[model samples]
Target: MTGFIVPGSPEWLRLITPSKVPAILGVSRFKSQFTLWHEMAGSVAPAPVSERQQDDYDYGHAAEAAAAEYWKWKHAGWRLSRGEVQLRNPSLPFAHLATIDRRASRGRSRRVVEVKTARDLYEYGDDGSGEVPADYAAQVLTQQLISGWHDDADLVVWPQYGMPRIYKVPFNEAVAAAIVARCAAWVESLRAGTPPNLDDSITCYETVRALHPDIDDVEIEIDEGLAVDYLELDARRKEIEAAARGAKTKVLDAMGRARVAVVGDVKVADRRAGKHSIALYPATKNLSQIQEHAA
Candidate 1:
C-alpha cells in the first residue's frame, strides 16, 4: 500500500511494490494443476483419475496457436504489447499480461479489443447455439472493469477464428466497482486460508468429479454423522481451486482483449508429427557443441 500510488487520479495506479508484484503476476501455470484437480473433486459424481490422463495434459498446439494469433493481430496493424501486469485489492494483489491494440480510425486513434481465446470458447444450448459463453462473459466483464480503470477506456471482442464475429460491451464505474469487490472477496478468502465454498452447485461438483475420479467419496456438504473428514478437506481444496480458476479466467480474458507482441521469434528445434519443441528465446549463438570435438 505504501508505494502503490498513481500520478493523478485513483484510477491510474495501484502502488504495487516489488515484493507483492511477483505474487500478483507471477506465472501461475503450475498452480493450475492443483486447481484443476480440486475442481474435478467438487463434481457431483466426483470421478477421480485412476491414473493421470495425458490427452488433456499436453497443450503445445494451443500455445503455438496463441502465439500465432498474437502475431497475426500484430501484422494486421494492431498495437500489441506483452509482459505480466499487476492487479490488486485489499485482500490480494496479482498481475497478468496486459495486451493493447490501438489504431487510427476516422483520423483519430481507436481501441476496441477483448481478452480471450479459442480454448476459452465453449458451446452450449439446446442445439449447441449460445450467444456468448457465460464463463467468458464473467471474465470479459472483469477485464473491462480493469481496463476502464487504468487505461480510461474499454475493450471489444474479436473472435480469432470461425465466423467473423465482434462485440462491444459498455463499461461503467459501477461495473468496475462490482468486479473489484468480487476480486477483493476472493483475495480475502486467500488471505484467511479459507477459499469461499460456493454451494456445491450441481454443475461445479459434477464437473470436478468428472475430471478427478481418485476420490471415491464426494459430497456437497459435510454431514457430521456421515463421512465428515474427507468432506472438509475436499471442500476446502475445491474452493481454493475454484478461486484459481476464476483468476485464470480473468487474466486470459484480459489478454484476449489486447493483441500480443512477443519479444522474440520461436524456432522449432525438434518435432515428431504430433509433438514439437520450440526454443523459448531466439537462438543467438550457434551450437557447435553438438559436433564431436577433434578426437
Candidate 2:
C-alpha cells in the first residue's frame, strides 16, 4: 500500500498562517512576541503603534529640540549629542539623543535618553501635552541593547500643538537582548530565502484573508509553474526582506494589514470588470511573473 499527503489541505492552512510562517522560516521572533507584549501593555488603541510611521514622523528640527529639552529634564544634565553610535556588535542608529543630557545628582552615574517627537500623543495620554509614541520605545530599547546600556533609555515627546511630555521607561536587558537576537535571526532567515514565522494570538491570518473579498475563492497551485516562477519570487522576497530594517512587530503587522487592503482593491477591480476576482498573494512571485500569469 502507498500513502500520499493531500495538497492544499486544512493542515496546510494551519501550517502556513501568518503566525506560523515566521516560525517555519525562523524569522523575526521579536516581532511575534513584541506584538503580544504591546497588546497586553495596551494604552488605548486596539493595535500598537508602528515604527515605520513613527520614523517618518520623527524627521526635523523642532522635534529634535523638544526631545532634547525633555531628555534634559529627564536625565538632569546628561550630555546630549546627535548621529549614530557604534560599540562592539551592530551599530545603533539614534538620530536625536546621541549623548547623555543629564548628570547624576548624588552618584557618578549617567544615563542615556532618547527623544522622539510627533504630532500626536493621544495614544500615550492626554496630559495637556504630547507623549512619546510606543513605536519609539522599541527603537530606544534596540539602541540600549547595542550600547550595553539596557533599561537606561527615556523617551521625550513634543506634540505639534501642545506641551511636551517626558517619560522614562526602563529597558529590560533580557527583553532587549532577546529582541536583538530575534531580529538578527530574522535577517538570517531572510537571507536564507524563507518566510519568517511569527505567531500572535491577536494577529490572525484570517483577518488578512477576510479583508480580501477574493480570498474565499483563491486558487491553489502545485506544479512546474512554481519552479518556473521561483527565481522571480526569490527577488521579490529579497525586496520585502530588505524593507525590514529597524522594523518592529507593530510595523510588520501593519504591512500584513496593508496586504489585505491590496487584495481588496484587486477584488474590487475584478468586480468592476465582471471577471473572476483574485486575492493578492504574499510577495511569493515576481512582478513580471504576476503580470504574465495574471494577464
Per-residue C-alpha lDDT of model 1 across residues 131-151, encoded as one tens digit per residue:
444333434444444443332
- Per-prediction count of colliding residue pairs? 32, 17
Q: Compared to the true structure, candidate 2 yields what TM-score? A: 0.40
Candidate 2 segments exceeding 4 Å error: 1-59, 73-75, 82-110, 123-134, 197-295
Root-mean-square deviation of every model: 19.2, 20.4
Cα lDDT, all candidates: 0.36, 0.43
Please, what are the lDDT tens digits per residue for candidate 2 over residues 1-295?
0232222233322221222223322343233433322222231122333886556544634466656756566555566555323333334221112222222222545345555444445423332223333445555555455555654555666666457666765778676556555655544544454542434434434333333435455666678886768778889889877774434343444555343322322311111111374233233223344465567
Clashes (candidate 2) = 17
TM-score of each: 0.36, 0.40
Best by TM-score: 2
Angstrom error of the Cα, residue 217, model 1: value is: 15
Question: What are the runs in model 1 whose C-alpha is more than 4 Å off?
Answer: 1-112, 115-131, 149-161, 201-295
| Candidate 2 displacement at residue 184 in angstroms | 3.3
